[model samples]
Target: MSEGPGATAHRAVTVRGPLSDARASEQARGDHHAAPLAAASWLLTTAMDLHRMAGALAEGLTAESGDDAEAVARLTSRWTSLHRDGGPPAEHTRLEALVEIRRPRTRRPALLWQWSGADPVAALAASSGRLARELVAVSQAAPLAEAFVGPVVLAPETAVHFVHETLGHSLEADNYRDYAAGCGLVVGSTVAGPQLTVVDGPLPGLETSRPRDDEGHTSRSTPLVEAGVVAGVLTDAREARRQRLPRTGNGRRAFGAAEALPRMSALHVARGTTPHAELVRPVRHGLYCRGAWGGGSVEEFFVVRPACAEWIEDGELTGRFVYGFDVKGRKISGLGALGSVGDDMGVFNPVTGCGKYGQELPVSMRSPSLAFDRLCAVPIAPASPSPPP
Candidate 1:
């Protein structure tokens, strides 16, 4: 791949963290026992000028490495400080301590992409007409303006929410395998109305672009639902064949060696007709949901946190609710309960990755602000993870 400005290069190695490779391999082979993790990291140049050199090194390694096992061992040794069976314990302790030593930094509006051109950012900047109007409405309607200030792009946020709630969590093949709730359970079931449709594609215009999945397959969009009916399950090649469905290019991985699984990319909710104003005004006692921070849902039971919600009273935009909602019941049930869908769709580029089966990768979601008749909500509380060791 050609390297551009602001680009850098690195060499990587994978190793077990707080665990041994033998233990990780055993666990992977289904002899599950408690183990920390098999982790990987890289040591590379930070200068943008080293991009070409980095690429060349990576290509050289792949071409010249004698074998997979030898390559992996060399990479692991170079990137990680191996502590065979027994170490001074000082090494492990120091590494554990180092994890929390770095001070948290303020987040900024930064761009992260590979081999990107100037056109995409330009498109996002130019497409802000509707977003600008929506943000004005949100800002004015917000109970407190000072609390909400940044590059407020509504369309992208809307797209993200839609994909997260409706697509990403919904299409997981594991959920389908377990006969779990939400989109998976109703795979072949028909929809009740025109309120549902989902498609995942790495379409050129969408932000979550992937030319080829880690599984070495050309990417393409996979339709999961259509016109509120249970159309199909998202599938990788394996699941596609097993379930007798077409491979939707959902195969993805954390890296080249990691096993692939069905994952969503550039999920898009089917187009709808409800105008932005119309979706908001009709909510007599509901919320205009926007931007989601993070969430976890199992079998359609989930709690969306740090989400921005505006209280709707009468037929007008109202004040902000500040807190988020805990959506209970079956996920598909809730989706089946969708009250209205909006016309504008957006994609979110969160500074986070999607983790499944211990692999993490960059992902994005797209959706529009939605309103429901009876969404569950609650107050925020203290977190459990240690602030910093």
Candidate 2:
């Protein structure tokens, strides 16, 4: 079978007795050794099927784009042997695809889409549709009004990104070592209300789950925060050794990445007991941020642009607002302002790249609707009106 660039095949053989005798005895054992081989075969078949589906999707996009738009797509299929070091390797396969579209001679920003999952088709289609709708809405949207600062209820999806950007990245061991940043030094410090907890690990059945990291370390769930107190920080071998901290198995390397680093896999805020309705019911006047576009951080402070938001009045949604707003605050302060956490949660595998040290890795986050008190929401400069056509 054809493999992508950097793909490597691994094999191992064990003989309990002399080769001839072992083979004869194994044959008499009733094909017990065949089980692993069968499983590996099935995994390979699945990966090949996903590859074909990706190719078909690319072809369709190319035809639809015609010559006006340039389209580029790539599919990467990863198969890992879970028990490679043991009796027989357990095969694991992961598929990720990315599609980029740009209209030549136009000043519009290029649209990027990405997906990662066992089923490539469904993930790809969902990402493409979401990107298309977002682009259209952004292009047609009018200038927004001044943003209201204070209490706000973040949608589940928006909360996922917020927790990822504000907490996950800030807790990386490298960030702690390099800049003296992160919550590492603040272990046992209460950073939020008792209802807030954050976790990071290779959660099973998730698109980002894995048995081991790139450095051959076994994966385990690590609690970054629990009951509002700092619990732990993610660590790779180097950082763990330097800081004399236990490794959390967070070492990860991007495709074609030269070196492994401490990167989050499946990071999320644990769900709270608060019902979904009650989380927003107490909000008298606030914004309900449903989505986000671009965001980044400078040290402990962070900023994210809301893609779409609605006004909340009398503990209910008023209407979809058209203006852009910036959510800004220090990480710890933002968490400390948590009014409540909802029971309904949303998981997201983002298409936009999360860049660090010039390398981008696949990551996922999940969180319930979160309400914050005393946070700043400032209006962005109005978009320049389209030149009179």
Candidate 1: where is the Cα deviation over 4 Å? 1-159, 181-184, 324-329, 384-389
Q: In candidate 1, residue 120 scores what lDDT?
A: 26
Q: Against the hidden reference, what TM-scores do the models get? A: 0.59, 0.69
Deviation in angstroms for 383 in model 2? 8.0
lDDT of 2 by residue, 44-110 (tens): 4443443343334333443444424344444444443332222243344444544454455454333
Q: Give the candidate number with the greatest lDDT.
A: 2
Best by TM-score: 2
Candidate 1 TM-score versus the reference:
0.59
Query: What is the lDDT for 386 in model 2?
Result: 97
Model 2, residue 373: distance off in Å is: 1.3
**Model 2 regions more than 4 Å off:** 1-93, 97-114, 120-142, 179-185, 382-389
Per-candidate Cα lDDT values, in order, are: 0.44, 0.63
Q: What does candidate 1's lDDT look like per residue over 83-172, in tens digits?
A: 111211101100110000000121211111121122322433443343333333333332322222111212335435534654466666
Q: What is the C-alpha RMSD of each candidate to the true structure, in Å?
A: 16.0, 12.2
Q: Deviation in angstroms for 138 in model 2?
A: 6.6
